[model samples]
Target: MTEITPRIPPLPRAEWTDDAREVFAYWGEPNAWEEGSKTNILMTMGNHPDLGKVYNIWGKHLLMSNTLSTRHLEILILRVAWLVKSAYEWHNHVGYGLNAGLTLEEIGAIRDFPAGDDWNEQDEAVLRSVDELKNDGVISDATWAILGQYFDMRQKMDLVFSIGHYVMTSWAISSFGVGIEGGADQIGFDLRTASGKIPGKTYKPGEVEDWTDTRGY
Candidate 1:
């Protein structure tokens, strides 16, 4: 990958005032404010605090509250991130994807999925759904049927919104030239890394390779 230089460099920390501080605090500890948090995106969005607040709220819902399996969600997110060339989002989520039970091969295979033998039927369906949404803005009936076999209505809806959400995120980060968070390249997120300090543990795939909310929702 070529080097990416942010056209809109993050606002200097020195410039952070009350409102900036509020947005910073809004995202909260490890995931948002801790030392190596992916704050570059947050800070860039922080340039406009009101927008940042709402964005973070929706983001929290997507990352934390949605009913989709973390494995499936990560698959959709990473695929969109790769196709859109949003290295910032891709780099960060790679760890989240791994923690959510995607093996390195599975993550790498996302680049050339359905054609290869790497993906199982459900995985193929998820990736195919992303492809359809990315290219055609609609999931073909065939792909939807495959997904329906594994996912319920809420999960299907979550898949659509998750892809759409990441699509917008990629566009914004690429257009704004947002770089990775400070010091991320030196020690970025990895398999051992959990997705920061969520109140509970990150979701792990269960016996059926389906997700069960450990927290009981």
Candidate 2:
């Protein structure tokens, strides 16, 4: 994994104010501010408690109440993490993905969809939609038709919103340089070591036109 010095280091527990504590409380038992807590993303959000609180509300919905199946949700999340190359997001979701029932080979196959025989028709459509959204900012008609065959209107909406949410999340995680939590379970494939088959341009910080070979499929 690429080492990133946090541009906005996680706010220490001692510095957490009442608002921050309340925001952290949303995660339930063993409050995030308590000792031994390893939710670095929430800790980083502590820098802006108001944002944390609201963001948590939206995130909570996606994680806890979304109409999409756990398998599909994790698939979307892992794909976005791979597309954006957010190691922190990727690492955390790898555990979530596994727990949600995706096998290691299936998780690894997310790096390049349709290249392996791990996915079914619906699963393949979901993967393709993620790539389409990433590259074109829209899901193509063909992909939408495939999705319509299996997902309801609500599920489709959740699917798109979930992708957009994770994309935004990956941006924040990368920009904030949130590192993997301490003692995090060693599960899931690391983006640094995963092989990617897709082609896309790589942009350096602050250099719009000066890009190198395609990276982060």
Top candidate, metric TM-score: 2
How does each model score on TM-score? 0.78, 0.82
What are the per-residue Cα lDDT tens digits for candidate 1 across 49-159?
778778878887788777997788888898898788777677767767767877766776785666545678898998999999999999999999998999999999988
> TM-score of the candidate numbered 2?
0.82
All candidates' lDDT scores? 0.70, 0.74
Structural RMSD, model 2: 10.8
Model 2 C-alpha lDDT per residue in residues 1-217, reported as the tens digit of each score? 4456888987776787888876766666243446423466777888899999999899888877889998899999999988888777777676567667777677788866667556888999999999999999999999999999999999999999999999999999888988765543323344333234221122321223322111121
Cα lDDT, model 2, residue 49 = 90
Q: Which model scores highest in lDDT?
A: 2
Candidate 1 clash pair list? none
